[model samples]
Target: MKPFSVAYTSACHFGVIAAVHLPDDPAPVPDGVLGQLPEVERDHARTLGGYRQVSFVGGRLALHRAIRGLGRRAGPVLPGEGGQPQLPEGVAASISHKRTLAVALAARDTHGSVGVDLEDLGPARMGIADRVLVASERALVDQLPAQRQWTAVLLRFSLKEAIYKALYPYVNRYVGFEEAEVTPLRDCQADVALHLKEGEGPFLVEARYQWMDGHVMSTVRIRSGTPAPE
Candidate 1:
């Protein structure tokens, strides 16, 4: 297999986004690439079948590149609870991928956990809107022009996925789609409102997104341990 290459890299509010393009053929990843990863990651990749292994390896490659961009040596990104990336101390990171591309976001853990997600700009599938959006969000989508509704739903979906990733490390639980609402603003930014059940309160979260090679890339940062407002 040909070596994977860095597609692009950009700075986001939370950290840096690194995207890598996977090989066109679905052939197994080359030993050279696999050899570069930590033994644990290599073993885990071995267990995954077909394109899954490809995605896993590509995501780690992108992550290592992102870490290097931060002037840090890349460490083993083991799978933590829920298979999230177990980043090195003082680092926060997230990974997402499509068939041909993998993206990662990495930042210093000074502020909080960070998450990143990538989604293709395909037409929305039927009934996906109902599944992803809360009532109010659905109402907002309904007001958009017909052609833009799909993008609207997808933008919120991508943002919510990033939001969940950023918050899950702190909450240590499954946060439902309804648990948070995203109101997208201009300039590829959005505001998130968390409605966690009593006792899950007090996380400061923010999100941003951009278009990359016909895909929607979203990211979020979450700060925990703060007291709820009086």
Candidate 2:
């Protein structure tokens, strides 16, 4: 109930979910991160790298609050597969990020778990889909009104990444854009559907995408162990 910042949250078979926004600050040239950043990323950082450390702080704090809040009722935090943070023993958890938010979810009776994400919308990049967007996705994104296509592209890209992070620890399977298709629901307030293709993938993934405050934020949550509700 804390004014816990969030990009997304949901009740699960486990406990509760918390998502924090990773504030964008001018990033300092940290020894390791700078070296690891791609050439292009490095170039961008060069312009205003002085305050880029808040990327996940908001999400981290929000997660802690969620854990604390859940602990008040469920217990403490536990670590999950790949050293991911989870609820105390006998609990399951998942974390996700998009642009400036990180979300964490937990429950006592879920296997697949929960995840959330946030994405910032900006000017259209030249041919992003050529590399990240799948063929069909590219076609769909391109089909949007010229003015709206970029938002749609960013929306899909952000949601897909969140879905990947949400299910990665449990499924441990590589998910490309083709594996997950996103369809936005229509309404003043709508949610995005993270449709896992027919195969060995997350059976049901739920997500929400919103264009607010001049940025596109998206959240993805997947429930595990429980069979997909028809």
Candidate 3:
């Protein structure tokens, strides 16, 4: 089968953002290549279901290639305290999997942090929107056609997830849903503002998303010292 896709972006001046999509069944990793992952990763793979294992390894494989493409070597990407992948020094990456689709995004140290998330598009469940959306966002959704509200909710949720993944390492804590908001822009893009509960941050993350083979993919790139958008 043809490989899914790989693309680069200049959204972050400090480093290029590269994304990879694994569409078909993930290619098997040889022992040598699999060995490149840290023991935590290998051990974690064993704990996942068969399909989850494929995605887990596929994500690591994609990250290896992404980092290598930057002309640098990233040693075994390990799992941190929360099972988030820990990139080698001077690098940051995020991975998301949806069914057969696995996407990974990577950036160099200068870029600060990178995060990407993929979610299958579907209608929002009752009460979900209220739980995830802030006041202004909910008002915007209310103005849209009833049928369209679910999509808006899903988009906001996905953006928040991407933001959370990007900031968790720095925050060292879980960011709440009510604490962040996403405002849509044209061409499948959005701006996210996060109000860190612990007063550590009021950071901003710029996001762009696309529909790929039935999934919504959102990517976030945060440059070091990037201030909140006015």
Candidate 4:
């Protein structure tokens, strides 16, 4: 069997599973796989173009595979609080797509919650970094060499997204980029502290990233308390 790009790390109690799919030569996804998506997903699919459709399906497929690998049966993957993929009870997961590439991560509820994101490496978007980075984050970016700063900025962006996804069920509200501070550590790993506007937080999530096939893929796993009531 051909291999999928997957990374695994122990987070919380159980394991965090991150899987990546590069559809440069994707195999066909079964129609039955599409059938497993909830109505919201079906409607969302209708709005996707050809490339997105393929990546969406591929993401769903990768998600299913991840779930099954966790020893659970594959079932409907729905959108829940904050539009994140709602996993089966006792499961927490996240999915992200960039152009033709999609990535997903999952862990049993016992493992806490997980969020994954993928971003293609490229020249800096003119105003994006400033808009997304908080004062300290921007200052840190300035400390890096000119050429490598954008990649760091993009990595922070991806980690912020991963944090939002990981905590939305707990926070149950929109989290902006400025709410969290991301510090990239060594070994392609990073840490985030969520400074939510209200509620009991300053939640912490850890992230791991990889650079592959010209893309930066990041995954955040939170395994402290259980997910917030939904």
Point to the candidate with the largest TM-score: 1
* Ranked by TM-score, top first: 1, 3, 4, 2
Model 4: residue 171 alpha-carbon error in angstroms: 1.2
Judge candidate 3 at residue 213 and give its lDDT.
Answer: 64
Name the regions of candidate 3 deviating beyond 4 angstroms: 2-40, 123-127, 202-204, 223-230
The whole-model lDDT of each prediction reads: 0.86, 0.55, 0.71, 0.70
Worst 10 residues of 1 by lDDT: 1-10
Model 2: how far residue 186 lies from native, Å: 1.5
Model 4 ranges off by over 4 Å: 1-49, 224-230
Per-residue CA lDDT of candidate 1, range 1-230, in tens? 24468888877788888888887566788888888788888988888777888999999989998988788876678888787887789999999988789999999999999989899998566378888899999999999898899989999999999998898788888888888899999988898888897568588887898886689989999997664779
Candidate 4, residue 174: the lDDT equals 87
Q: Model 2, 1-230: lDDT tens per residue?
A: 22224555555333576665454443454544433333543454445533333433333445555655565443333334554554455444555555445566555434455555455566677477665566667787778888888777777777776677666655665666766666666642234344455455435566766566666655555664345468
Q: Clashing residue pairs, candidate 4?
A: none
* lDDT computed for candidate 3: 0.71
lDDT winner between 1 and 2, please give it.
Answer: 1
Candidate 4 structure quality by residue, lDDT tens digits, 1-230: 12233333233222444454445644444455556565666566656666666677667656766676677754667666567776778887788877555666767766568888888897567379987899998998999898888898899998888877888777778888988889888878886766777855535476888787778878787755434667
How close to the true structure is residue 59 of candidate 2, measured as C-alpha lDDT? 39
Query: What is the Cα-based lDDT of residue 184 in candidate 4?
Result: 87
Best by lDDT: 1
lDDT for predicted candidate 4 compared with the true structure: 0.70
